[model samples]
Target: MLFYNKNILIVGLGLMGASLGQALIKRRQSKDDFKVLGYARKQQTVDIALDNCIIDQGSSDLESMAKQADIIVLCVPMLSIESSLQAIKPFLKDQVILTDVGSVKDEVIRASKKVFGNMPNYFVPGHPIAGAEKSGVMAANSELYDCHQVILTPDIYTDKIALNTIESIWKFVGAHVVEMNVEHHDHVLAATSHLPHLLAFSLVNTLNHRSENREIFHYAAGGFRDFTRIAASETTMWHDIFKCNKDALLEVLNSFTADLDILKEAISSNDEQTIKSVLSEAKTAREYFTEVLQARSNK
Candidate 1:
């Protein structure tokens, strides 16, 4: 395994961090072979991580624990990325690999480099493109990234050696990895990932306040469950995503609003053919996406 000889320091032992630890352990990554450390704000969280075997050791100090790591994976909230990066900037070892699980990659890349000057070739901005609707270390599991997509946004400055090693790390955990630019990642994700999450949150909020809650609750089925499923995901992570990708997300949101208005007009006009054709096209499009998704899964 790629992590076999590396010491990994996971900053913030939250859901993503703990899940990564479990995944590494399930893959038979030994504690001595690859030291896994966790940095959490709470002593209780540190104890929990140790009890769950998510990490070999836990500490609340970044610089102290970070000095012993070969790779540092920042799994904190987006708003905290810059500050955390700065905190560890002064003491980062040369050639030490760095990565993050943040949804917003462009800003993360910029801030990371700004705080830590002369980054080594191993600093790659990565997102697993996978998570659960649960938060915290207690809810973490090892199979979170099984057959999932891990997107790496490697810019010109990204060290080729570093990117390849990062890719290997994800591959060892059963993730199919792909490379893309930071801007394209932000734009495309705003449509496919970010927008859907935003809509899910809005839909659940709208339904929760309705007068006929009993009726809505009674009819919650596959569609409702699927729609609201991601809505239950970690709000802090999603909130940071929206806030950090504000400009890109807002642009896409505007386009979506325009499309929704067109559908609203068609529905209001009682245009049966328009509604039928629209729904049919959507179903067809979703089928294409499913086919692509299945192809990736089979790999």
Candidate 2:
């Protein structure tokens, strides 16, 4: 009902975009209430989405879709988001509400400003804090965002109506919407999401490069699999995310390095008390995090 009688165009029919199309289709109340259109660079993605009934229509031409769209959601990677914006800028109607699902917000905000000269009042910058290790339309699911957090990083110049519409759409898709500034979103996500992925990728690569990699994998258990699951995420997307949020990522990486050094020194010195204290602290933090997650889920 939030987007009643609206033509919503989704750019890039990958995991996030395809999932969004499915969500919107599930919420459709009448033939005229809402329509979902998807555009991807690959015609194969469009064909797959159409066959799955994820979108009412699909196309490889972005400009034509943008011309008819009342709302456009950019589901492309952080690095390509600017190009997508630029491509559709010439075709966007004055009332079109533009938004994105990129993980990094600051870079997106900058990109929009660069393309439009001034940030468009209708552009709402957002990040949906949900995904899987898989990529592409085949991996999309309507339940992917159910009860997940979606953060909106709106600037002062953003239109109130447009922001509300974007928030409503995410909430309708079963996301718990939250709002913050772009800088804070980047900094927090760097510590919580980006750093972990970086560590996972590094750990898996380091182990794979060793001569004993076969043995290492043979002896690996659930813990290794759990930690390395995210390392299987699409490399191109992660590469763009890391590049866009490098400053915030670097800050968190340095802090993590310092903590790692402390653990290394304790282990090398065979300091039983220090090691015990560190592990105890980590256990306490982990317990607290679990409790927090449980509480959020209950909400």
Candidate 3:
């Protein structure tokens, strides 16, 4: 109902944007259902989305699409957020609600502030904590966000109606919506998502350069393959995230390095007690995390 008769424009027709369009199309219930529009930098990407019915309509032209959207969701890379904002600013309707699905909210907030001279009341900074290792329009799945968590970071200037509109749309797509401040959102994602991706990329790179690299890969077990799976994610997108969120990521990285050093010392000194203590704590924490995830899925 929140999207009734609305023109929902997705400003970047990549995995996240295309997935959102697919989900919206799947949720259509009647003739009054909202329209889904998509925009990508390339006409080919737009054509692919249109051909696949991922979006009702799409184009490579941002200005034309921007003028028609009642709700605009920017799904571009972190580095392009400001540029995208600038491109669409002139055409945005006064009633349009703007949002984003970027991983780093602090950077998004800064970009929005810089573009608008302050964060607009109708602009909501959001992050959908869901994705696939694969990227691009072809990889988009209608259920990618099903039962997933979508975090919205709204500041003091955010309009309640605009925030509720974003929340309603995400919930309609099967995501569990939650709210957090920009700083807290960035910090939490740094420790959980960003750090893991960094470690995965680093581990894969390290193994790939080893003398026994081929043998290492050839003999990779289930755990090794599973842990490194995220290394196959889109490099450019992750690169932008790392650049935009360096401060928070570095904070978490420092903490992780300190722990890693302690573990290294324990292993080097052959301290059985210390080794067991660290491993035990990690195992227990992992179990608790698993429990929490399972519980949320059950909900």
Error of 1 at 159 (Å): 1.7
TM-score of each: 0.94, 0.98, 0.98
lDDT of each residue in 108-156, candidate 2, tens digit only: 9889889988778899999999999889999989988999999999888
Model 3 per-residue lDDT tens digits across residues 1-299? 77789999999989999999999898878636899999999999999999887889888999989999999999999989999999999999989999999999988878987998988889999999999988999998999999999999988878998999999999989999999998899999999999999999999999999999878998999978977898998988999999989999999999999999999999999999999999899999999999999999899
Candidate 3 regions with alpha-carbon error over 4 angstroms:
none
- Listed per candidate, the RMSD to the true structure in angstroms reads 1.8, 1.0, 0.9
Model 1: runs farther than 4 Å from truth? 117-121
lDDT of 3: 0.92
lDDT of 1 by residue, 1-299 (tens): 56567878899988889988878767863456677888898888888998998888888877788888878889899889899888877777777888988899977976766776654457888999888877899987888888988999877877877788788878877788999888999998999899999999999889999999668978898988988887988877888999989989999999999988988999999989988888999999999999998897677
The residue pairs that clash in candidate 3, if any, are none
Clash number for candidate 3: 0
Which has the better TM-score: candidate 1, or candidate 3? Answer: 3
Q: What shift in Å separates residue 249 of candidate 3 from its native position after superposition?
A: 0.9
